[model samples]
Target: MSEQSVTFRYRMSDRDVFYGGGVVNGARSITLANEAANRLMAKVFQNTGHCIEVRKVRLYEPCFAGDYMEFMARVRKMEGNRAVLEVRSFKIIEVPENPPYPSSIDVLPEPLLSTVVQFVYETY
Candidate 1:
């Protein structure tokens, strides 16, 4: 079950919003990206003796606040026990806002971009 591309879509909740409070930052764009990669790796190694672990993770873009985020993962290259994955997260800010206010606003915060992360797998 090798996947060249994987996409995960999720919405933002109040918990996901940070308003100068301690909420541990629920599900955000970065989290979604990591989860997408993990899910992709899980699919790639499904039922196989090989298991993958994220060696490094970085954000190339900053996830905006109050926006729906989508993470896309693509398998770039694969070696014996190492694989390179490219992931990009996009935030959609076209959702309608509450009434009795100003004009349409782009609540979507700047996406937390990330570079390609290399993952290593161990097989026995």
Candidate 2:
């Protein structure tokens, strides 16, 4: 790979669920993506690196308790001492529930969160 990357899966549990519903908190979803970003930043941090901020963070769907989330991060661009990475979280492993379609047998869908994060390496 030309750019450093990482992928991992998380099983959302009751602790991560939001109030009044099985809905996973948006903050938890962001953290999921951030974990991946941290990996990429470490790979490029020959200098003192820190995540400046995340930009264009978007969530398309509600992740719920018992959903298996897949997280991935890849460098979108690196210029000078700054690197931008794209992070995404997807609901992969689903379960049986009130079936419009059988959740147990349904195919995993697209990403639920898409975000771009900028990491800066301080040169002194």
Candidate 3:
């Protein structure tokens, strides 16, 4: 079978929030990203007698509260039972609210959040 790439997007919710008084934490994003990447790999390797494992993961951007985050994964290199997959996370910021200043303010990292995960798959 030929190697293929898969992508998946997940919206940020109270459960995915990390720090800034959110339910989730920075490390939570890592777990979410890893799970998503594994799911994508499973879809691509279905019926191919292969397994997937993450090798490396890096966080580039921070997803803030009330923002939509998207994840994209692609198969970069494949050699025998091993394959490298790259995953990126993007945050969609929402429009600011108007009117009086709020008592509490939530701060988060700027720009989009990105993560690259490598996986190794073996066929039986």
Best candidate (score: lDDT): 2
Backbone clashes in model 3: 2
What is candidate 1's lDDT per residue for 16-123, written digit by digit as tens? 666453222533554666667677766675522333666655555433344566778777677666656656766655244463554344644554433345445453
lDDT of each: 0.56, 0.67, 0.58
Per residue, candidate 3 scores C-alpha lDDT tens digits across 10-89 of: 65667666576543465656666666557656777653344466677676655555555666666677687665666666
State each candidate's clash count: 16, 0, 2
TM-score of 2: 0.75
Task: Report the CA-based lDDT of candidate 3 relative to the real structure.
Answer: 0.58
Alpha carbon lDDT of residue 75, candidate 3? Answer: 67
Overall local distance difference test of candidate 1 = 0.56
For candidate 2, give the lDDT: 0.67
Model 3 bad stretches (over 4 Å): 1-3, 21-24, 47-53, 95-113
TM per candidate? 0.58, 0.75, 0.65
Clashing residue pairs, candidate 2?
A: none
lDDT of 2 by residue, 1-124 (tens): 3367778888888899886768778889788777777776666554336666566677776777778878888877766656667787777766556756643534466545533333332322
